[model samples]
Every structure is written in structure tokens, then in C-alpha cells.
Target: MSEQSVRRPTQKSRLARYLIPIGSMAAALSLIAIIYLGYDLAKGRISPCEAVFQESSIGLKTKISFLKTEGELEIGREQLAELTERAQMTALNLKTCCTVLDAGRVDPEQFLQCKGSARSYEARLDDIAALVRTAVKEGMSTGSVATTAATAAPTPPAHVEEQIAQEVEAAKAVSRDFNKQVVQVRKEQALETLQATPPQNVTIGAQEREPNSDLLTTNGLSLDTWVTAAIGDGKDSDYFVFTTPKTYRDRIRVELQNRSTTLEPRLRLYDASKASLGDRYNTTTGADLSYDFVAAPDTTYIVRASNYYGESAGVYLLRVTPTKAYDAYEPNDDILTAKPIELGSDLAAGIMDGHDQDHYRVETGDAEAQLLVTLTNSSTSLRPQIRLFDASKASLGEQHNTTGGGDSSYLFKAAPNTAYYIQVRDYYGDAAGTYTLTVNEAQPGG
Candidate 1:
């Protein structure tokens, strides 16, 4: 196996002369050359192209490694699930964002600038969406592999971890930028498409059907907080939550400030399954809708909003007061936080990145170290128990997580930007502590 010398013909010297998008090929050609050079150096032979291809192939096959983890978390089916879910989320979300801008609400200016931080705004959500799609495709493949390992023969693949590590590393680096680029492109021009006339109604031997329900629906919920017809309408107070878990009787109220205005807005919510619950509000101006939960909780439902759609002119609040307990966190769980934690003044907007909300970025490296956090004690007496749950959905057989009198220590892994939940168990004859947790990855995982 020798690395072939890379022989990329220059774009300007292409045999076929056709205009093209330069940035589109920039990262790819560069990646190919870098990969080729590395391959040749590694094999000490001259077929770099083959080496690069081999590396790519190996990366694909690495997901869902059948080997046992020496200890700690994982490189298993869960990772794939997470990746796929991310992909779907990104895809759907990106389409929604693009649709909004096309509809004439969001400004295109965010993407025109070039700073990474600048790109961090709504402009880069497309990149995250793309990344999610890639992750999902790979995740499905990973699931298949895991299933095969679970039932088929016991032959093991070599260095699956290393292969996967390389892929994950590469994936993280580009996903955000990809999403950002999409936004940037949008910013440079108006969605000229929005100006196009709506489709002609060719009645197909059918009575006019109910105006197709706006594609957005809150089946997962029945009631939600309506801040106003438009968000940020000079008045900032608007919010709500799921009144009853699994009970989809939405109790929250929304008062649209500009229902008379032709604004189509989107409302997003999350059920216990971590599924997205959304509704598109096409305006005649605006009307209020209440969302109720449809299922019981092994989890908590979360809510947030976006205005790529027209109704974005006003504030819509989705507010919920927990009549039910904040059971998502148990009394004894140790929680990790987001480093460069997104600073939000209040829970109304927990945190948002250029790509999404409720999620923040962090860096990780090769070894697990103590995690960074700030904790607050809530109960007068429940001491917290920190437990380690692995990707297999299996609790590590031997490692008992740290137990705390009130608060506690150390992050548990080295998977760069790897996410893990801290299990806080109700403990030692004490009331639970409501702690504020923050995590900073001293190094990003590879």
C-alpha cells in the first residue's frame, strides 16, 4: 500500500472550461492534497491518492465499533443516534431558516462578514444542518454495524476507535462552517424567490381542500405562551411551558401583535423524546394556539422560538411554570456545563449559537480530566450521587460515580466536545441542591 503523489489538475487549467464557485472547491482540493501528502509520508510509498481514499474508507467503517471500551463512555450506537438526530435536526431547521429569509423577514447582512464569531449568528445554521445530515447517514450505517456485531460473528475490526476519531475530528471542524456559509450566501442577496408569484390553483377534480394546514403544528403540545403578534416588539416579556407532561392540552396563551400583517412564523417545542414539535403560523395577521403534551415523561419538554418566518415582527412567549417538579434532573446527578458557556441574562433565552439553541460548543482532547462546573444546593437534605452511564445504555459495571454532600468535581472524558449527562441522585438524608453547572473543555476531543 503506497501513497500516490497527488496530481490535481489546476482549476484554471481544467480541460473543460466552465465557470464555477471557487469556495465550493477550496476546502475539498486542499483536503485531498493534505490527505495525499500524509498518506505518502505514512506508507513510505508514492501512491498518495490511494492512501487518501483508504483513509476515507476506513473512517466510514469505524462507527459503532464492536470492541469493548477499556472503560468510561463509548464509541457505539449512541454516537450514531446522536449524529443522525443531529443531521435530521440540522436539515429540517436549515430548510426552515432558508424558508424564512426567502419569505422576506430575516436580514442577509449576517453572512456577508467573515469572522468565525460573526458567522456564529443565524447565518451559519445551514452548516450545522449539513453536518447533522452527514452524521445521520453515518449513524444509520453505524447502527447497522452495531446490530451486526450484536448478533453476527465475533470477528473484530482493527483500531475502530482511531478511525472514528479521525472522522469525528474532521466532521466537527467543518460542520459549523458549512452551516455558516449557507447563511452567508443568503445574507448577500434577497430570496428573490419570495417575490415570485404563488403557485396557481389548478383544481384537480376536487373541492378545494382545507387550506393545507400550515405545515407547522404543535401536536406535541396544545398550548404555548404567545409573547405578542411579533417578537422583540419593543416589549421583551413573553414565555411559557408544558402545563402537564404528556398531556397535549396547551394552556399557554399567545397574543399576536400583528396578526393583520402577512407574517408566517414558526414555533418550536421539544417533547420528552427530544423530538421537535413545531407549527408554522401563516398570518391573516396572527392568531394564538395552545399546546399540550401528548406523552408522559421519562424526560422534560423544552421550548424555544425562531423568526425566519414573517410573523417575526413581534414577540411570542412560550412560558410554563412547573406545577410538576423539575424532574429532568434528579437529586444525585452530577452535571457538566458548556464552556464559553453562552451567557444568557435569563432563562427566556437559555443559550443560542449561530446554529441552534439549548446547545453550545466545547473542545475536548485525548484524555479525560476534571470538568468545570458551578453548583447550587436546592433541597435542604438530598446529597447528590454522580453516576456514569455508558453509551450501551448500560451503567458501567464497576465505576461508582462521585457522590456529593452538596456539590462536586471532575468531568469524565476525552471525547472532544463529547457530551455526557451527570446523574444526580437524591442522597444522604438531605434535600436536593439546585446547582448552576458550567463545563469548560480544557482541550477538545479528537
Candidate 2:
């Protein structure tokens, strides 16, 4: 349109043109701003705490993935699976905490909880890393050994092989040291957690009752309970006494968990007569002490806890538990201490360890009797073996099963009024298990 014919452009038209474009531009800027704010908020940028938590959660997830891949290749499958499960659980917890914080919930308790979870996750990662490192180093050493053994034509010099062995040993030592450090850190963390929150399902006993340095004034402890106490100073000792259960044979475990960084725990066990049964001490700093024994029925036992160096003063937790119930006859590991068994009796017992041997004494009547002794394996790993011995501790005959979880029998003529011994053990001294030994008169002309 011609300017003259249309006359000068109206101010309204000019304003309309500029305002329409400006309005459109303003709307576009608003939309962009909204998207930016939403993205920033979603990424947990609302607060410093939320930001830190979000960062931590992402970092933990990444670390866990790496650990899972590395652990599967290096560590045992079961161990790796367990670690992975724990890591996943921890990651879920961290993510939940981060979400809560991101939602602008300012709860001090929740914040503390998240902090604790973070610490736990870090500790777990450290432990997994240590395990993987150890496994990798061990694998390397094994591969080196195999290579050295297989190389024949291009054999390395003796000194070179020796040097390789030395290097492998050094690597092992480093791995061991790293593992120890990780163990110490975990122990310290566990102690802290325990102190912060006492365990459930446990009767919290009293603190150290002074003058518990002797049997007469010792503190009494209960089974499946925790006792929190402290050592005052050098030469300070804490004594606890408990009665064994009335069960025929009880496996008792005494544990001492150190609570202070400066304290190294030492545990000593004793009987009712104040005779020292045994002792255990922590070999590393911040390690726990544990001692186990098979106690006689309805007997009193004493446990003494003291600092390893008898110097540093700190807090500790002591607990006693009956771990297992053994058969009526135990401590009969040799012919001299053989338990007496009656004829036509079947007895159940266990080989407590690979090196354990059970002995039983059988007495014959006034007439010659043919005895049929049968040993039946009760554990899948045990290959039963039976040995007959005269009263003079001389072996008469022996029979054993060729395979595990099998039975063995022996037939012999018993003299009148004579004491004979029956010994039982694992065919190979490497498996521990339970078995039943039966003694009966053999049928004649059947």
C-alpha cells in the first residue's frame, strides 16, 4: 500500500507489531527458564546437603558397578555374590536418603542417618576392594608358579626364579597388610556403631563391678548377653563368671570386642577350681579376642579380660554363648580316657575336628562272647573307621569304609571279664563329622 494513500503509519499499528513479537519472545524465554529450573531441581541443586547426598549416591552406584565386575572375576563366587547384594542394599539406602533430602525435608535425624549410611557404604567398598586386591595378587602368584613350572626349554635362571618367588611373597605381604588395615577399619566402625546403638535381643548387663579382679568378687555373666565394661588403667582386670548349661556337653564361646582404639583385648578362661583353661589375645591392633571350649555340664567357668599390654585403658564388650550341644560322651579322645559303653548299646558322637579320635571301653561278661561292632556314618563328609584294641592299648584289628557316608563293621571274639577299647575316627584325618557306634552279640548259625 502506498504511504500517501494509507497516510502515515498509525502509532497503534507500529506498537502492535513490536509488542506482538516481544510478547512471543518473552513467552519463549519463560518456557526456557521453567525447563532450566525443573532440570536443576530434579538434579538436587536446591540445597548444599541435597547436592552432596546426590553426588555421593551417584558415586557409590558407579563404584558398586565396578566392584561387582572386578569381584566376580577375582573373588569366590559366593563371596562376590554376598558383597554385591550388600552393595546393592547400601546403594538403595543412599538413594532413598538422597531423595528425601532432595524433596526439601530438613530432618536432622534423617541427615544423620544418611551420613551413617554413607560411612557404612564407604567401609564396605573398602572391604570389597581389599578382598579383590588380595584375590588378584594370589591369582598372579599362582599363575607365576604355573608358568615357572611349565617352562622347560627357555627356563629362567635359578636366581631369576628365586627373585620371582620373592616378588610374589612381597605381593602377598602387601595384600595381607592391606587386608589387615581394612579389618582394623571395619572393627573400629563396628565398635562405634555398637557404642552408638546397643544390640537388640540381648540383655544389657551392668558395667564393670569393681573388685572383680578375683574369683570371689567376680561379676556374674549370663549366656547370650552383652556386658559393657572398661579397664581403668594398667594392672586393671575384669573378671566374669558363668555357669555352663546342664546339657551333657556344651560348646561355650567367650568373646571380647574392643571398643577403644588404644586397647588391645586379651581373654583368659578358667574352670571352677580357678585353673586356667586357655587364653586368647588379639594379634592385631583393634582386633577382637575369642576363645571356645567344650565345658562340662553344670560347671562354673571364669573369664578374664585385660589389656594386652596391661597398659592402655579403654572400654570393651564381653559376651558368652553356648554354641553347640555335644553328645553325652566327650573328652574321650584317647584310649586312656575312653568312655565306658554297655553291651547292646548304641551311642551317637561326633568327631569334633579333623584330628579328633573317639575311644570307648567295652567290658565282656564271664563267658566268651562274639561281638559285632558296627559304625554308621551320620555326616555326609565322614568316612567311618573303627579300630579294636586290647586292654593293653594294642591294636587287634581295624576296619574302615572306603567312601564317605558309609558304614564299617568289625566282628571279634571277646574274652570274659576283659576290657576292650573301640576307637573311631575319620578314614582320612581331614573330615569332621558325626557317627553312631553300635555293639551287640553276634547271632550264631544264622
Candidate 3:
């Protein structure tokens, strides 16, 4: 070999050596970039997990509030069952959310915290469902078997509602706190994940016969049984038909009850001739609306219900039954035909209408006795008022407006052979119930 050939081989070897090192360096840099890119992509997965966790958290809150309200109202068995189904569905979704959140692996400790919190929320919901079922069972066992009350359950106490509300608030707080932690962990991983999506307003799902979606007609419902329904949004109304089978000689009594803190129920009655019965009942918050009147035989009666404010919605339980004929003598609303009660005698009467009043006449027979008049509610929630009047219907003294589970009493000196009238009316003109009136002569300081 010559000197030129050897020089060429040496140059080729140098070039090959330099290119090999350069190519290896380039490959190493590419691998590092790819690894960094893939890590960023893995962190990006937290965004969707955050979204799901947040959504499920809010949904759980709404369901808890709804359950509390249902329990407070002592809703019927069917409504309770519907609420149970909703809770179970929400629990299932929460479990899915837990799995997704865990897969994100943002922070192992926080992921575990969130999972445990989600499980706690689901367990609380299950407890609420169980409570509703127990309540329904107890109500069924103790309810009146008679067709009059129509197996309608009694209203639960105020404390029961308060307890339910407290429990729901606690569970809601847990869910809220867990969601906050999730967001915090997500932020630690990627600050952009902190931008939580706007939450949607939650509303209860509409039932089959939603008042706004479908009209409840006589064709769907009958009398003498309890029916449960909801008053949904936007001018919702419920209609029920009651037909007196000619054999019904007494009046038909209809009742509407609910525990909606938001809805004020209003009810009206109509006859087969499309004539208004002029029977109307409107109640305030936490009150029931009822109508009792003599319906004609072989006549079709229409009962319509709606929220008085036209803006609220809730579930309501209704029932219709035949009631005994009212014995209140007509035209005796005033002092004209006032029923006379002897001294030391007791009389039972009721205010059957919204604007109704009862009057009684008493004469102190030639004896300067100590007169004690008392009015008591006959196991009812009606707040009553008592007024004393002279024979000329002039007010003798201030009106008596004592209320609550106690009786209204007026004690005064009785003159000899003087006739006075006692007037009984509902305080606020919104209460109606049976009450007992007693006139007694208390011994002088004995």
C-alpha cells in the first residue's frame, strides 16, 4: 500500500468515529424528551378525574337534602321507595367516581382520603334509605285500618324533621370537604386542574304523573284511598275526582298533607255540573289543607290542588272519605239564634268553614256568682279566640287570643239576671277544628 491509500483509510476511520458518537448523543436527547412528554400526559389525566369527582360530590349533596326533606314530611311508602332508588343510583355513581379518582394517583394519601370520604357519603345515604323504610313500616303497622283515614300516616314530630336535616347537613359537609381536597391535590399536580367546571342546578327527577307534564284526572284516581304525588315546577297542579255513589248520605271529606317548607297548598272543590262548591282551603308553611262538605249523591266532584305561591314544588299525600253530616245549625253563626247553654254546662262545637264563628247565650240567674268561661281545642291544632258581647252585640271586653295546646279562659264577675253572648272564632281566620265550651261558676275564692 502507498502513502495516499493509508491517509484515505485514516480519514474515513476518524469521520466514522465522530458520526457514531454524535448519533448516539442525538438518540439519548430524543429519549429524554419523549419521557418528559409522556410524564406530562400522565399528569393531564387528573383533569377529567377532578371533573368527575366534583360532579359526583354535588350530586350526592342534592340527594342527601332530598332524603332529609322526604323523611321530614313523612312521605308515603311509594315516594320513599322512589327516593331510595335515587340514593342507590347516586351511591353507585359515587363508587365509579372513587375508582376514577384513585386511578389518577395524584397523591396516594389524598386519593385514599377521597375514596374513604366517598364511601362514607354512600354509607350515610344508605342509612337514610333504611330509616325511610323503617318509618314506612312503622306507619303501616300503626295506621288506622278504617277507610276513613284511608291508611294515611300521621305527621312526624318537628324534632324528627330537625334530626334528619342535621344528618344531611353533616353528610353534605363531608362530601364538600372531600371535593375540596381533591381539587387541592389536583392543583399540586397541575395548577390548571384547579379550574373546576361550573356546577349545574340540581332538581328532582319528574315522576310518571308529574303535575306539569300530565294532568291528574278522575280517570287515574279514585276515592277512599291515599294517593301520593309531587307538585313539580312551573304552574303545576293536581286534580282528583270523587264520585258519591248515591248510597253516600253524608259529606265527603278530602285531605291534602305535605311537609314542604316551601310550598303553601291550596285546594278547591267542584261539582259534576262544573259548579264551584265554594269550598276552598289554603294553608301556610308546614300546614295541611283539608275540605269537608256534604257532596250530593250520584254527583261527580272535582278536587284541584296547587301551590298558593305558584313557584314552589314538593310531594303531597291526599285522601278522600265520607264524613258524617255536620250538625251545626245554619243561621246561628251570629248571636241571633245563639245556642243557649245553662250555667255550669259544657257544649261541643266546631268551626267547619274558614270564615265561620259560633255563638252562645248565657244568663246569670239572680245570683252574683263567679263566672268562669273556658274554651278548649278538642285534640286539634286550631288556634282559637273568644269574645264577650252584650245582648246588643256590643263588645264587653278585649278579645281572648291565647293559643297552643292550652285552653282559652275568661274569668269575671257575673251580674244577676243579665244575659251575655260568647263568640268563638278562629284566630288568624286560618284554623278550623272542633272545640269544647264550658261555663262554670267557680266558688268565691274556695
- Runs of candidate 1 exceeding 4 Å displacement: 1-374, 396-405, 411-413, 428-431, 441-446
Q: How accurate is candidate 3 locally (lDDT)?
A: 0.65
Residues 207-260, candidate 3, lDDT per residue (tens digit)? Answer: 224332222233234566777766776388776665775643355778877857
Q: What is the lDDT of residue 332 in candidate 1?
A: 20
Tens digit per residue, CA lDDT, model 1, 235-353: 22222233354422112332233443433344456554546666444433344433333333234454444344423454333443323323322212123221223312111111011
Which stretches in model 3 have alpha-carbon errors above 4 Å? 1-251, 254-322, 325-331, 399-401
Candidate number with the higher lDDT (1 or 3): 3
The models' CA-based lDDT, in order, is 0.38, 0.72, 0.65
Off by over 4 Å in 2: 1-204, 328-348, 353-371, 376-408, 413-433, 436-446
Superposition error at 87 for model 2 (Å): 70
Candidate 2 vs. true structure, TM-score:
0.38
Give TM per candidate: 0.20, 0.38, 0.33
User: What order do candidates take by lDDT, descending?
Assistant: 2, 3, 1
* Higher-TM-score candidate of 1 and 2: 2
